[model samples]
Target: MVGAKMSNNLPCGRFEMRISESLQPFIRNGLKGCEKEGLRISREGSISLSPHPVQLGAALTHPNITTDYSEALLELITPALSDGSEMLGFLTNLHRYVCTNIDDELLLSASMPIGDLRSSAIPIARYGSSNIGRMKHIYRQGLSYRYGGCMQVIAGIHFNYSLPESFWLEYQDFTKQPGDPQSFRASAYMGTIRNLQRYGWLIPYLFGSSPAVSKSFVDGRNSAYSNALEKFDETSYYKPFATSLRMSEIGYVNPVQASFRVSFNSLDEYIRDLSKATSIPYLDYERVGTKVGGKYRQLTTNLLQIENEYYTSVRPKQLTRPNERPLRALSNRGIQYIEIRSLDIDVFEPSGISIETTRFLEALSLLCLFHESPAHDIRQYDEVKHNALAVANKGRDPALKLLNKGQEVHLRTWALILCDQLQEICEALDNGNKARPYTQALHKQMEVIRHPELTSSAKMLATMRDQKLSVAELVLQKSREYTSHFQKTPLDNSVKRDFDLQVANSLEQLKRLNNASEIPFDEFLGNYFSKIPEPAKFPGIDRKASQVR
Candidate 1:
């Protein structure tokens, strides 16, 4: 029989043109995760700095990842961006937090108890970091390469450690200025980072890991070395998607540069205290650590060669599937918090992310929560994990089908509607752009998604093909810009002093990292579990009550 045509069947929800009144608090303050600041060097000498994947994760983890922007973000910096120096300064400040404030252990924890393990329980991760479970241990192992061989080097630091809300809000105002280069568009919290001077090494530029280096596991299945987990429109609905780190493999999400903060805990708690979450997926903290061995690093999994007990750790799988005929959409059974995993950090844009884009994400999360999640009869997070990969990497390709509403659906159509839903979210975030940084960024993205000329990944690959620039070169170019920009932002006397102090601190940390030939992994574990050592329960949820249309 001929396959029936898809009707776009976009799921409807109780949504609005503007962010609902209830989510104001969440839009302003619910999620928190992790962020990283790295420098990428490109061959062409054109530099770009990412607003740390960890930071993006951190931003998504918290509902309030969007902070209040100042007219200055709209005013001072947008204009300064033309100068290149100011734009660089602004990004630097944002990167600095990832450099200085991120907790190493939390990041390490993100990957511990590797494989489909972390998903087995409810976890609370610090902003854009990892759950307090085995994931912490896993990341530490990844750091062992050059980071002193001990996970201890990568643990505990809090969100407000260096950059506080006041700092975030300092440049939050961005709309007072009018016009494109002349007028204000939307404000951003990244201004502080963007305008900072003398801060080299604050750029988060690490791209996807090598295919061979990221897996670790006894099961070769977990270590499959293909970027096969993404959905690009393929016939096989449940293709496994995961990378083999040097030691283990955890469940893989699509295209890598995505984010989500989740837990296996109670629905009420997840909902009530989501504002307190701090862990993020897909973000890596910049420690004085290095990736060593012929072993490559995976997306969320970090490593540790500690105490001679090689361990793989990371959050448990979020998606699972039992069958392919019907799409097993979002799950909930006390699956209280919604995972926001579709965002990509736009490198070319200021703030690396934008107010508009974030606002849309904020809206989507709300929509998912307020309305009902669609359903079909499929179970098994492990399978769903593989299905997710099919959706990501193979999404644009033909032959792939996604189950929607108990009926077969083309991945492309689903993706378009998904993007449309995202559009609705962006439009709802902030009618005036004040409260919709996520949405604002999304609207801009909507334009990009539609325009062939602005295809980021495609453009990047094409540039590489045309110019013959190595990925390394493109990364370095990004690094150099951040390096130079930080070299010039004017800092106040106090900040200058603080900056100097931080430099001293960084040097000290670097020294420690350098001196260490090898530290035992056991000690690393000892120190890690000593705090917040209790794991949360996450039994297989029935989720029947949570199903939507």
Candidate 2:
């Protein structure tokens, strides 16, 4: 194991006054995992009309592979591992396996999918006739209705991480005020989630790569922010200093979700508010109707069909049991890890991400955990949202300002402060190694902040300008390159055999799920909602959702 030296001053403020040497190994070796999503486009760069490849196994039962909102939008997940390199290698292998199985289709490398897409054209994923399968499909149907299918096709990556038990145990001992180990761990993760949101705008400014998008993203409809985007050739639209259009108002932001009031202040508050949203009826969704024409239009008329529908940049996560709700799992096991959902897929990488990105994210997770995180109220929450959109829309603009503690601060100034603190954390993560991979990752990102033109968003726009290529053309070219890159590198026989076995097992699992005896759809929904009992409140946590966002 790499050795980390003790440091007196870590720029970690009061929270990390003295991080123990025992915790250093866990910080350096945090478990990292990734969930990458990409659109499966035809060779001509249009959305693929074909169903998910049968060769890859049933989308319903596949542990590592599944469909997102669309039948053609593939999501690949990697198991959490201590080494970032191993995590990335596993992700690469998953990509190779998918490419080998899917014939004549390419995974679009860019986050903002470019195609002649229409709401009717994109196929919603099907998971067979089981009750649970039907529930999944119907929930997606609700999404398509609430937020158009066009927006659902915008793909990105999710970074999942958790500090090791050693770190948590040492941390619990350090804090000394915690009740139980699980409660302390959950509280610590909640703090991390809050900090992650507080400074998440930096994510887009540094790594966002979706400044330009296809004209068809709006599908011939007049967009409210049509004036915000300038024409990039006849076939595309773009924002001059935009970082991630995928994160901007044009992408994932929506009116219904904008009004969502879930809390990151505490696990109990989060579960209570989220559970209430899932149960309380929303008038707008009510019009869609739970069952219309004898078919389920959605799972419910509630503000959220389920917890997953409430979108955020980050989420406290717990692994759920079979047929268990995500909230129930968290209430049962505390936060097992956190899922960082704001990263845009780097078009330059064959696996949609890189080892540097993973290492950097792991370090960031630790920084958030160790840093002081104050509880947030509604005003602070709105500020967070405003800053996120500002950075997403115009992060590269020289005059861009973001809200910091209700005051406007230049984006670069705030970034520098964060990076300086991050450098110390990364140094400790490097553990006196000569390679300094973590520090190197932080340095590369610092360069992007110093020279905005070096950002992925800027590079994407520059590439388009230099080549005089439309967004579709440039992304399609990269799609072809990535397809060949993955296909040409054959998976090892052992790995190939393992994937084949998984495929077979997934198919069998789906069959069993579909054939198993089950209750009626209405009864299933009732039972599901009924199971979300009010969790025992944490010792000092405020239960009011109004106190939070």
Candidate 3:
């Protein structure tokens, strides 16, 4: 089926006539099988204030496990895998491993953390005596001062994905482009990223789960959403039509990053903009100061402490060696993968995410890649940002309207059109398999749109309203339920041993890093910042000149 369509006229004839002719077979072969995926799932849970049995130190040294911002918050990561089932299985085992180790703690199943606790009560993650470790801990301290620690505890999942190198090679061969392989691949990935920015609002509409939060989460803050105050009944604060308060202005939204103009046009533009932001000092952050009372408050007083500080819904990424900066890695090598950072943890799934959701996200990414992506100006970028904010706050409202090509369109109408397009991609992905998981997942999203009450956020809100429970109370109840389930169903003895080994090995690795340091901590910090190469001098053919329109 995909083979027949591959021969059809390429949209807008983006490729040369001869190149387009060669692409049919390549597209057909590429669409025939499952693509591999890399996933990183992060979840945060508060330790019981009365019985804090686990130390944050344990999370710092663990490889597969770690804390995000607070000692009470735990994050589990799974290695990249071709099989979604295998990935979920690994995540489950990691959760089980953590559960077994924590004597009297529970991993929160909800996206929002416990709301009753004060910001000062949450401990930042500490990574021993190493300079790098201290840098990480201090970065969190800066985040705490910048955005209150309560907000930092909100958890979510990151899905990292890349088409196989073989796929890119096939694409390059089909297009007959004249550039280095790595540069071509990076440009191709950037095209997909542009499309994602244009149409990413649909994501929160479909999967966003944090419709409400405990009243304490908004306490003393100037909130723009009047629904919270009007709807509050001395327990939960929420908007009736909200999808994810966690993704909205009330959550991780930083005013400082709101106007950041990082471009997706090419690798150089992206690196240049990000590099400039990191080097440019901000008066607000300067007021906070890098150090207070001889203690490091942050790594720097720049608009961004580092490239990772630019909080976007998606990012182009390359894995780095120890002590290597992320932007430096990209400047030297190119994008290895793209990270989807907007997904909220689905409370219904014990693994924080389900295989079905993973499949849908994979399908969405492929759609983004194959679509006709155009270069976007700052106006379009702002439009995309507005759409995402609207969906996060008022997505469930049937009358919600979003900007599409500068025209107002009903949210449901726009979403349904996207879902239909996604179904076509799902068919290509399913290959010849009868049990089409991708198509099923798309259909499920359609159902959620048709009946907004069926969305996860809506369901959570309903439960809270009916039970007269606060967000903290509901999440705590769910946490205990999941913890008990994990306790009863322990991992296989071999799996348990493997995790124990990983824990031991990670500790040893940390010790080695600490002992091997030769440079003074202050000197190491200066050298690291000073050595960040300018983007124009980045090692790659200047592919920006020949970028696709």
Candidate 4:
């Protein structure tokens, strides 16, 4: 799918004009979904050491609510919906149901948790006795040993989306491409992923909510990052003009995979490289040992215990069947969706996201999909990483400069240009609707870009400084406020009943999985890694009927 190199400049007006009339309506039908993660905190505002509440259902089997890296980290997922408002409504109900179940515990309202945490203090999430469940638990254990548990506990929102097949068909024809529809669609999605890598920094700058943290977050770490952070107060650390510390090096960014290059040039290249990383052993992890003293310390001594361990701001996703490997699913099928992983869990919004944020992201996804994308090289890849860190650390700096096509450009200048391009996409997304919600969403983000203080990180800092509250204090208060709000407006009876039924069903499913499984863990692990599929081959779309209209 690698094509001729194109200039980084976006062909906004020309691209909009050239898109076929039939394709415009499909823009409004793109599917949107969200996965939001929040830490369960005690009433005193420290990370809760409690296990996942049983009333909410089994964390391993629940469809909507589950644990992420930590037993206390609640990850709530929403089903894909065409309407952003509906998707958010589902997410809201999930939160309300969860709040009703967990007695007295507040959902932490910030991306970065507040408190002093040693790696030993963070609890690894547990699954039951099933082989699959055990694999999940051991994988997290691997993460703790490899990256330390502190990094694993930080939470954020993942926006998942896919354009309608009608849109893809029109887009493929519009581009005069000749390939299998599935192949072309996956290739197009890869192009979008590549563009996302190039421009994804914008998300953190606009929506980033974590700029400061409890000093205890990095209490004893002796690294360059310690010097980078300024003391906000006796209890906190912050960067004066930072956007999202969560997206920065101190967050989920992994230094171990720095030398590993996973290509986005093509689906085959991406699969090949990622698969190789899983097989190649890293000396540091080998020293940690996969199994030590009759206990599994980690999954493999490989650079990546699994593909999920390779943290990135964006990922191409395919739906996986039960017991199927994610890589195998992608190889057998094709790209199903793209996950936007840079979004911070918004502190002010009870749902950790807003309709405005959702609409803006949808428009941004469209822009990435429609834009002409060139394949990435090592130099471009480095620039993307450098730009991401710059925005994460100092995005609100008026003089912040980012590398665009190897030339330095002011952050504000680049942002304005990107917003201008997004305007057309937003308009198309708002077609057939008089409200123009998508356009409004884009305009709101533009205002944030113009007024740096309007960014979430700035607002959070302002609140902290004005009141002289510690990071923990501010978030704890917000958590209490939001939890109260949700409690006041409980879920509708039908919704409540549905959630309750799901909880019962999930527990039953987990029990069955635990009791029915008989395979030895060693054989299960062997079968899993050995099933990694070879690179796929796809035929071109029949060219006889294809014509450039």
**Which candidate number has the best TM-score?**
4
Model 3 poorest 10 in a row by lDDT: 32-41
What would the per-residue lDDT of candidate 1 be over residues 217-256, giving only the tens digit for each residue?
1122232333433322221111222111111122222111
User: In model 1, which regions exceed 4 Å deviation?
Assistant: 1-34, 37-91, 94-139, 142-356, 373-384, 398-400, 419-428, 431-440, 451-453, 488-494, 501-549
Candidate with the larger lDDT of 1 and 4:
4
* Tens digit of per-residue lDDT, candidate 3, span 264-346: 89988898988877886666677789978988889998768888888888889898877888988998999988888888887
Q: Candidate 3, 73: how far from true, in Å? A: 1.9
Per-residue C-alpha lDDT of model 2 across residues 1-549, encoded as one tens digit per residue: 112212212122222234567667768768889999999998998899999999999999998999999999999999999988988999999999999888989999999877767878889999998988998999999888877788888899999999888877876665565598899889889988988998889888888989988888855333466568989899889899999988887887766655557788999989998887777666667777989999999888877889999889999999989789999999999999999999999987888787888887887887788776778997889899999999999999999988877678788878877777677688788899999999999989888899999998999889999999998899999999999999999999999999999999999999999999999988987888788864333333322332101
TM-score for every candidate vs. truth? 0.43, 0.93, 0.87, 0.94
Least accurate 10 contiguous residues by lDDT in model 1? 196-205
What C-alpha lDDT does candidate 2 achieve relative to the native structure?
Answer: 0.84
Question: Residue 345: error of model 3 in Å?
Answer: 1.2
- For model 2, the superposed segments whose C-alpha errors exceed 4 Å read 1-18, 220-222, 533-549
Query: Which scores better on lDDT, 1 or 3?
Result: 3
TM-score of decoy 3: 0.87
Higher-TM-score candidate among 1 and 4?
4
lDDT of candidate 4 over 1-549, digit per residue (tens)? 112222345312222223346677887898999999999988887778889999999999999999999999999999999998999999999989988888999998988877647777778899899988999999999887777777778899999999888887877776678989889988988989998999898999999999998877867332357678998988888999999999887886766676667899988888888887787766677788998998998889877888888888888899889888788888889999999999998988999999999999888887777777888997889999999999999999998999877788888888888887787677777785788898999999999999999999999999999998988788889999998888889998999999999999999999999999477998998888888853322223122222211
Candidate 3 clashes between residue pairs 3 or more apart in a chain or in different chains: none
Model with the higher lDDT, candidate 1 or 2: 2
- Which pairs clash inside model 4? 179-541
